[model samples]
Target: MGRGPSIEGRKNAADAQKAKKFTKFIREITIAARVGGGDPIANPRLRLAIDKALTANMTKDTIERALKRGTGEGATEQVVEIRYEGYGPGGVAVMVDCMTDNPTRTVADVRAAFSRNGGNLGTSGSVAFQFTKTGEIIFDIRETPALEEKIMEVALEAGADDVLSEDGFIDVLTSPDSYLGVKAAFEKAGLAPIDSDVVMRPATRAALDGEAAAQMNKLIARLEELDDVQDVHHNADLPA
Candidate 1:
């Protein structure tokens, strides 16, 4: 008989997963701080970046060093945030978010990926019009309804478009201009959400067949392997 699902094995697997995720956390923090500033107190984005680092178990020294680079205390490079729009296989529209010190090299790599992966690199704003910017916040269920109630009221008061109650979480959507106010409202209510960021939501979606989904996923994976690539959003919907 073969041994199945050993406990020690599962623990080791979890640890490895955590370590890999921690590396990505540090990278993002470093990049975020480098572009913005090290002081999280004054930089809301840096504060969010630090929160992510803490959640991923990044060490204090690592976080500090990243901050130092941001403030010019350490050897640093200018990392500009850029977004690429493309059409992936099956004519699926995709957008790639990147932070890079070298735009020339990054664009060349991104264009190549699109060409080799059965897609074409699109002109700026080509796919942008297909999406709308929204301030989306993902938070856990608080212990009491007071926090939830306050969040909804404050978000709506601040011009949020909608408030949703998912299975075990709450999502608040706001106009891009009202995002900061809504986020501040959540903080004022003492709810530290897991993540909050600006994202692109599609105006209309184009469905992909199973084969197209697989191809698109492969293309997306290839984009993720690039060091500069941060986030990839696509109109293709994947099965849950």
Candidate 2:
């Protein structure tokens, strides 16, 4: 009894999503360069950001402009990183990371999203203690099972904290300080990851279903739609 999108509608939606992703990628590249300097050789974060942007088909000219902006050349507004903590539907702890030129507007927008979604914003550190920051490298498992053992051995030998295989991928967890080294080791072993990033992992998860699950999904989607929001993390386990 649900209406589906027409072919044209689907194409339009796909285009919009791609545009949104490109915008976010640009923001990330700018921030990383700003914080760590414009030279990717000296800045691992910026290097990672640039790699992702390139993978997304961002033009070289666009990437150079973003780097210039970060280094205060041809810069207009100053952007700052901010983190907002809150609880979403079903009491799920949520954290929103944003890069914005205006903190007041960003906070107001985030608060509005939370309040409208049956949630309330929390004070700093209210929920941050329940999370840990770590480096995560994910590899697609397209080869034989023997590949898993090799990945685990190389990752751990190179300072990885843990290696987990699931959902057709292998995840290598490492301390933030050891991330680069572990990644290099994987590459040396001819095991390139499909994705790699530093992220905050939740210590616990909240199980939600039915109306609560639907509401949580809506809340996350709305938050992501905001231009300034870069990443949204939560400790909710919704039914697949």
Candidate 3:
């Protein structure tokens, strides 16, 4: 009989995963500061990025260094943001957001991930039409009872598009332009959110299961593993 995976191996894998997540968080913080300015108060995107980094237990020194790099105090290479559109297994529309200094290498890595996982790279706007960009703020239901009523009253008044409550959380949606305002309103109301971000949401979902679903998951995981890739969005509705 084959031996089970070693404990040390699992530990190493988990550590590697954590390190990758940290790298992505750092990149986001740096890019946000670079594009929007290093001051969080004046830069809503940077503020969100810093909040996420803090929530993930990133050190203050690490964040400060990234901010310095962003603001040209300790800068080296120039990192630019790019988006890749594609289709994954089972015709699932996919979008990848990346921050890279080398577009050539990033594109090649992304293309290879898609092709090897039974997917195809697409031209710009290929699958972008299938999604809508929106600002989302999520609050834990346990921390905010009567979440729906409270969120609706505050969010809608502040130009939010919708407030949805499910499971143990509430999600408030807003137009990209209204995101900062809505977030400020919630913060001023003393209803601090657990997570907030501007994201691409699928206008329609593609259902996939078994082999197709597995393949799609593999594709997404692979893309996410790339150093330059920041986020991966897809329309595939898999098992919860």
The residue pairs found clashing in candidate 1 are none
For model 3, what is the C-alpha lDDT against the true structure?
Answer: 0.89
RMSD (Cα, Å) for all candidates, in order, is 4.4, 2.8, 3.3
Local lDDT at 83 for model 2: 97
lDDT (C-alpha, whole model) for all candidates: 0.79, 0.88, 0.89
**Deviating ranges (above 4 Å) for candidate 1:** 1-24, 102-104, 138-160, 165-170, 175-197
For each candidate, what TM-score against the reference? 0.71, 0.86, 0.82
lDDT by residue for model 1 over 50-89, one digit each (tens)? 7667756788898888778777788877777899999998
Q: Please report the TM-score between candidate 2 and the true structure.
A: 0.86
Candidate 3 stretches with Cα past 4 Å from truth are: 1-11, 139-147, 157-159, 166-169, 177-196
Tens-digit lDDT track of model 2 for 81-167: 999999998789999999898999999999999998878899988888888998999988866666888899999899899998897
**Candidate 1 has what TM-score?**
0.71
Query: On residues 73-128, what C-alpha lDDT tens digit does candidate 3 reach at each position?
Result: 88656889999999999889999999999999999999999999999999999999
What order do candidates take by TM-score, descending? 2, 3, 1
Top candidate, metric TM-score: 2
